[model samples]
Each structure stands twice: as structure tokens, then as C-alpha cells.
Target: MLGRQQDEHVRLDHAVIGGNDLSEIDDAFDSLGMEPTYAGKLENDINHLSQLGFEDGSYFELTATLEPGQESPWWDVHMQKDAGPTAWAVEVTNIASVVDEIAERGTPVDGPNEFGRERPDGTYFEYELATLGTKEFGTQLPFLIEDHTPRSNRVSTPTPSVADTELVGVGAVVVGLGDLDDGIEVYRQAFDLPEPSRQTDEEFGAELAHFPDTPIVLATPLAAGNWLADRLETFDDGPCAYLLRSSDWDRTTERFSLTGESSWFDDRLAWIDSERLDEINVNLGVLSP
Candidate 1:
């Protein structure tokens, strides 16, 4: 039903990837060929942030804790576990209206809470946040953001190093679930996404469901000892992978020293080895055009 709406209510804002150290996060992504810009510390004083911006304005937000043993409302456990792509955000207009709509759909919605981070330049990046499903933050459901400052001020303009590359922006967020049916229902209730197309990847060892045309894919382990199962054991049900869009499929492959390749529904994608970017521990890849 949401897909039929005339005015778009939601769009991918950024993917939240947590790490133990900011310098390590920057170094890991730099080696991956997409350098991240340091966004400075949060007003809460718990974490420092960086942004890997893309042409579409969406980004991969690398978050690192400042105070060890201090609690971060959403990403404390994720940072502690070194969970890479732990949470995600969607941008929306009329935050109050969107919150009401999602609540009316039988999903619990929390806060248009004010949050901010100070940029290195001493200017502030202010925004409002609302989360869906649970308070834990990595709900496989997204938290919503509406910027008080210009969003351009919050997101780094693309640097020439990555701007010339084929990578576009975040195309899909792969959520690792314990149960496929339960995950599907959670997404359905939160956003009212239509029935998704389902499949299984023997190599990935998971069952997949792709919500049509959206940047959401739900994955559940096919058996014990699989990667998804291991991720769930530590990180629970939340984003496990983030695939960026590419303008040219072939150029994307040749541009980076890729670890392996795979398909997301019909689209082709290639990933960088996690070992290569061990500092960040992120499962990052690029999707073909």
C-alpha cells in the first residue's frame, strides 16, 4: 500500500556501521578505495562519526565510541561487538505525520527526538530521530531522520577519490534474521512493503526475500555454522551487509580488488574481502547497474 502512494514517504538516508576506533574505521574504508570524511563527535559525547558520501546523497556512517564502558542508547552493544552494519536510517518529510502513519499500521514508533553532532569546523549538524519496532536501535527496522540543518551540511560532499569511481550510493541493506517469516512480517508492519520475492542462495547459505524496488533484503540462515547464523549469534537481527550502487558493472569490478561476487535477486554485485578491511569489519560491496 505504501508503494502506491503519490508522495514518497521514505528513502535511504544512511547505513550505521559501528567500530571500536575511528582511525581504524577511516583506514579500513580508505583501503577499500572509498575514503570516509571524519564528521566529528556527537553532542552526547559518547561517539565520534564519519561519513562515506555518495552521489545520491545517502552515506555509510561509520560510528566509533569515545568513552569505553559508557552506554550508547542504540549502538553500544554493536560497537562492543564490532558489528559492522548495525543499523540504518531513512529520511522523511513531515516527521510527525510519518510517525503517526507507522503507528497506525500497528507498529510502535518512538520519538522525533533531537540529536546533534559537532563538525570539525565547529558548526553543528542537528537532526530529529524516530525509531520503529524497538528501543534497541538495530531492529532491522530503520530509524527516521529529518535534518534541522541543511542535509548537505550533515553529509560530506563526495571526494574526488571516490567521486570518479563507479560506486553510486547505498542500494540495499541486507538484514540478517533468525527467522525469515518473522522478519518479513516485521518489515511489513513497519512500512507496509508489499509481499517480497523470495529465493535461496546455496553459497551464501541463506534464504532471501527482496522487497520490490526498495533497498531492503531479508536474509535468514539456512543451517547452523553459516555466516548469517554467526552474525545473528553476536549482532542479533539487524543489518549484516550494505551494497552500493554502481554505474558500470564491469568498471566496478575492475576498480576495486574484489574478494568475491554474488547476485542480489537479479542484480549482480561484488564484495571486498572482510579480511582486507578488518579494521572496520564491514561487509561492503558494490551492485551492478
Candidate 2:
């Protein structure tokens, strides 16, 4: 059995972006100049996924239901509403030890459930996943993952275009909540994170904070009827955006057509123009590392 350490053992794995059409989501990423690798369909045949893989084994999992009106165990409302960042998972070295630690810290855990899938090339890979609480669709708390098969089999290498961009991996996940303090408390308790630095962004119309070195960002609406509030009403308090970390910030930005530049605390941030990502509600961001 693999042993585990504390929070240092956790790292950003992948953000699950759900949509109504899987193929359309693929085209959406392709339009952004990132090639999506088709992973495969779920065993239930209710969902399929394609991934935007990165250098550090992190990815953006673009997924959608295979059939309409069919309830998927993954998510119902988010998938129906084309919620971009519906859920997220962090990679851990030891599944059992981490689950035990979280449970001891007073958070409810549902698994280290054994899960696997077959790829298009007839290769198969498996992993263990555990929910932090009740297996709700858009829970603020992230799920945990550890690989049973070789991790490379599950996460593909980046294509040449993506490789040249120098994107390291997912840097942070932005979650929208009704109350920022409540969300912070939950994350702090679950992950043993320290008090985070806070700031309010007038341009984005939300007050956000980062949990030290972790990939979690908690945000709440600055006022009623703002974009964040609207997203909360639709997808509730779960992942709303994903920001990638780049090894070479200038090269990554020049490679893609970014709509505008922004800031995350002290780090420089840029956004992919939404117009380029047709039929996908996901907002993709890149941050200086």
C-alpha cells in the first residue's frame, strides 16, 4: 500500500467540464488551438469524454451525455445546463490513507471506489476515486483520485501544438459560491488549508481568494444579478473556471488568441476569448507560474 503525507501530497489533477454535446466541446477546444484527445465512453454508455492534456499530467476533461433525458450518475443539472466546470479532482499518491485522514478530520467520505475504462485503442486503465461528502453533482469540496494502472495510460501526452505552448498543468480551479467565508471554511476543514489571502475584483464582479499554494479558489458574488450569482443559480457552488499554469507565459499567450488580460492576486492572468469556444460555456484561463 502506498503511504501518504499531508496537504503537500495533493496537486491539481483535472477539472471536469460538462456540456450537452461531447463533439461540440471537442471542437470548442480545438478552436482555442488546443487539441482534445478522445478518452472514451463510460461503461454505462451514458457519457463520453475528451481531454486537453498538459505537461504535468493535469487536464481539462470535456464530457457530455451520450443521450438526452437519460439521468447520468456524473451530474444531472450541470450536464443539462452545459455547466462548464461541473466538478474537479485532485491527484494523491495514497488513496486509502488520504480518505482516512479526511474522515478523521470530520469530513464525510464515500469511497476509494474502483473505477476503470477502455480507450479507443483497446487499452484499459483504472483508478480509485473518493468523494469528500455526499456524492452530489456540484459539490464545493473536490473529489480525490489515485491511479491503479500506470498513470500515463490514463493521461495522454500533449499534441505538438499544445506541447509548444509550454503550459505546465492546471493551476487553479475557480468555484462560485453564495458566501465566500463558508466556502473557505469548508475547504480549510477538508484539506487543512491555511487562511487564504482575499481580494475583490471589480472587473469580474466577484470577491475571490486563493488557498496558499493549493489550486482551490473560492469566490462569491459582489452583488445581486452579477455573472457569478447567475452562475451560482445555474450550477450552484462548484467549479466555475479553470486556470492553467504556463512554463513560458509569453509563449503561451502568443500561441492562443486571448480576449483580455487579468490578474490573480499577484500573478498575471489571461483569458481565452469566449467567442472562439462556441457551444461550450467553459472559461479557460492561463496564469504565470
List where candidate 1 sits over 4 angstroms from the true fold: 1-7, 67-70
Global CA lDDT computed for model 1: 0.78
- Clashing residue pairs, candidate 1? none
Residues 1-289, model 2: lDDT tens digits = 0011125545777789987888888887787678798888888889888888777677888888887556777778888888878898888889899989889888888888998988988889999989886437336888888989998888785644487567877888888888899888878888878899898878778899887667778889999998889988877788888887877877876777776677777778888766746357887788884
Count clashing residue pairs in model 2.
0
Q: Which runs of model 2 end up more than 4 angstroms from their true locations? A: 1-9, 134-138
Weakest 10 consecutive residues of candidate 2 by summed lDDT: 1-10
Estimate every model's Cα lDDT from 0 to 1. Answer: 0.78, 0.79
